[model samples]
Target: MFNSAVATLNAPPVSIVLNWKSSYDGANGALIDMSQAVPGYSAHPDILAALAKGASDPALARYGPVEGDPEFRSAYADHVSQLYNAKIDRNEVQITSGCNQAFVATVLALAGHGDRILMMRPCYFNHESTLGMLGVGIDYVDCDDDGGLLPNCASIDAAIGPQTRAIALVSPNNPAGSIYPAPLLADILALCQKRGIWLILDETYRDFMPLDMDVPHHLFAQDDWQSSLIQLYSFSKSYCLPGHRLGAIIAGHDVVAQLAKVIDNIQICAPRVAQHALTPMLTSMSSWRQENRERIAARATVFRTAMDDLPGWDLLSSGAYFGYVRHPFTGVGSRQLAETMARKAGVLVIPGAFFGAGQDGALRFAFANAGRDVIVKLADRLSSLTL
Candidate 1:
């Protein structure tokens, strides 16, 4: 029998959204799928070659260190050190199957049954579900449209209870796509330190942030940062290799040692083939990553323009890979609207209700997978909807 906590949860959002596709008859046009946040483009040729070479090698098929491949961890540590202008040792890094697994391992290592983690409303669903199945409590502070969907440090500070073990957040957030400013992040980190709780920052989409923004934050450079901060990242979006399922955690050496126990029981180690293939490419693929960043930025601009002055749709906060939009129907729930849109308008998106409560009027459009032309056509499809 399944656990009640896990059994009571809603089905996976992406899988539910994809199932709606079965109702579409293609009457409107070619389906524009803005549901899942995957890179629209294919992996780089060099990366593909590396994967093939690594997969074919017999040695890479053996078990690796529970933390990760040594070369990959060192390569990633160097990459993080340069990016954050901070000192990071390879020993402080732990690679996992993906960012989701990274979160699971971090939670298992840091908190337990009845311990709470503070999260923003409209938080990533997977984070919520992960906590639920573990019997961990979740406390939320709402991030509204007026505040650009960023949580206030004072509000977060006030929400922390004695049992709260950590504050988990996603930058360039999943459903809202709102990037937290460095100063804001610093303020929140200070509050977390003051409260004696962990700050789990998920930076999965950091590589696609607008080019003009400064470094993500200076928290990594602070003395004793390792005591309170844990940063999570993914190689999937940046490298267009989600199927490879590679992610990492950068924390204190002690924290990494603790996580090794959790990860050892969870995965033994991340996929050896991916670790071997991506180790050198961390440095080698710099320019390629930058180019993709520019491409995503261009797509964001086009999406904004396409949504501008639309009769009912309001583009709330958009950047990175998503546009959080308020739909026209006032009383209709986003779940129903989203399904109707897919079947009639041939446009697929995730309902905001899936993200959290009080989100019935909104939809999360992951425009990263749609090209500019496809995005241009979105306005018309949406406009034609009568239901």
Candidate 2:
């Protein structure tokens, strides 16, 4: 039989959207998919060449170091430290199969059946479900819709209970791409430090933000940071390597050691070939990656313009890869409405309810995958929606 997490998640609603996308296939209808986190583009050619080299090496066929190959770990730690100006050593980082695995390891490291984790409402759905399946209590801190879905430190402060073990937040958030300003992030970090709880910050979308923006939160540079903070990341977005599935967690060396124990059973180690291959690129291909960031920023501009064309729909918050839009619909649920739109409008999207129950009034459009022309079609689709 399947587990409770499997039951609760009920398969990502994107699957249902995909089914509708399939049903509506036609040469006449436009197909713009904004449902999943998958990158619409491919990795750089030089990166592929490295992958080919790694694949052909007979030495890579064998099992790798469970902590991650030393070369990759060193490269990752150094890159993150230099970018964030955080003092991190190779021992403080643990490479995981991907961001999901990094999150799983962090949860396992910190909480259990009866312990609690505070999550912001309209959170990434998988975080809620993961804690639920573990029988860990997930308490939601209500975010103000008027202010955008950015986490308010006071609400977060109110959510911390005696049993609370940690707080989990995703910046350039999944459903709402609202970037929490550095001051707000610092406040949350201070609360966690005061309460002696962990702050699990998911920075998967951070790479897409304007690189010159002020700090990506100063939690990393704070004194005694490792004791109260655990940061998670995915190479999937930044490196355009989702299928390769490589990610990492940076915390105290002690916490890293604890997660290493969990990783022992969950994966034994991250995919050896990908980690080994990504090592050199992390160091050598900085400029290429920056160009990709600029490209995504351009796509964000196109999406903003497309949303501007659709007057009835409200473009709530656009950040990184996602645009959280409030459709003009009133009565119908987002799932049913999204399904109808997917078929009729010839575009696929994830309903807001999939992200969190009370989020039904909105929908998430992962606009980064589609280019300008494809995103422009969103206006037509919005105009066609009956709701």
Candidate 3:
């Protein structure tokens, strides 16, 4: 009785991974779950305290502005402006329930069924699923073997067809964890501008960039940047507030106005409690968030070292919270291997096939969820795998 898009879509990755958990019987310390890229630690006490205060405020219990709390719009605008070193205004921001919603709303606003959205190979699976349900066509901008699907102007030009409406990219990308370079990002944006297509950038992991590479890109500094750019962000990762379901969209006033309609119809408004809670702490919590970034980066180093010693495993690309690994078995599909790994080795990872096609032999390690010591144990488990 379901629609073709929903029926044709693959099984949910998390559900598939969780199913494997039942067979797990490894004698190792405990299950080392590297599945979801959630925060490894608790939200900062200050944030929790703020949340409590916001929850206690009866004024926030009622419905909020569909455009979002005006105070948060202004705060997030200022946050992005200072963070990206670009001039921004509150009018450009629209709060959403999560970055996923930000993406869905933006995608619906810009394109319709049969319209094309150009994306990178081995993309975040949810983006693919969302487009599929909407009956939108997906075209690819291929990435190299090194990890990131950084598209040059020529590649992007070749990928664009008559139906292509936008190019969507995720940096510190999900599944692969490749961070796109600044110059390359600028070039792609320029191409999108020339083509008169929107460039939808999802920077959910921007906070976790390595210290030397703090700023992810410089697109916002360009003249008339908003006309061609639609940026998506998440306070969930940065603030450890995923349960709060808070995210934002950065676009021109016209785009924000359009998004208001989408948000009004879908969510009416993002969760009001979290919006009120975070409004006061957005600027104040930067140093704390920076400390968490450093911690995650350090965990990345531990994960990298562990992968290096594994006989058959190859680390393809790693950044932020994820590592895309090429498993040793040549002919085995990733789904079967992932299941076996979960059962025998007591390790949990998502098979690469869930991300996109031709990804049968790879796996995505959401390594940031595990601490340094747990990451070290990953090497031990894989080393013991007989396959």
**Each prediction's TM-score versus the true structure:** 0.99, 0.96, 0.98
User: What is the C-alpha RMSD, rounded to one decimal, of candidate 2?
Assistant: 1.5
**Model 2 lDDT per residue over 223-306, tens place:** 999889999999998788888889999889999889999999998888877887888888788888788788888888889998
Residue 47 C-alpha lDDT in model 2: 83
| Candidate scoring better on TM-score of 1 and 2 | 1
In the range 266-306, model 3's lDDT, one tens digit per residue, is 98999999999899788888889889999999999999999
* CA RMSD, predictions in order: 0.7, 1.5, 1.2
Write model 1 residue lDDT over 226-316, tens digit each, in one string. 9999999999999999999999999999999999999999989999999998989999999999999999999999999999947779998
Better of 2 and 3 by lDDT: 3
lDDT of all predictions: 0.94, 0.85, 0.90
Name the TM-score of candidate 1: 0.99
Worst 10 residues of 2 by lDDT: 21-30
TM-score of 2: 0.96
Off by over 4 Å in 1: none
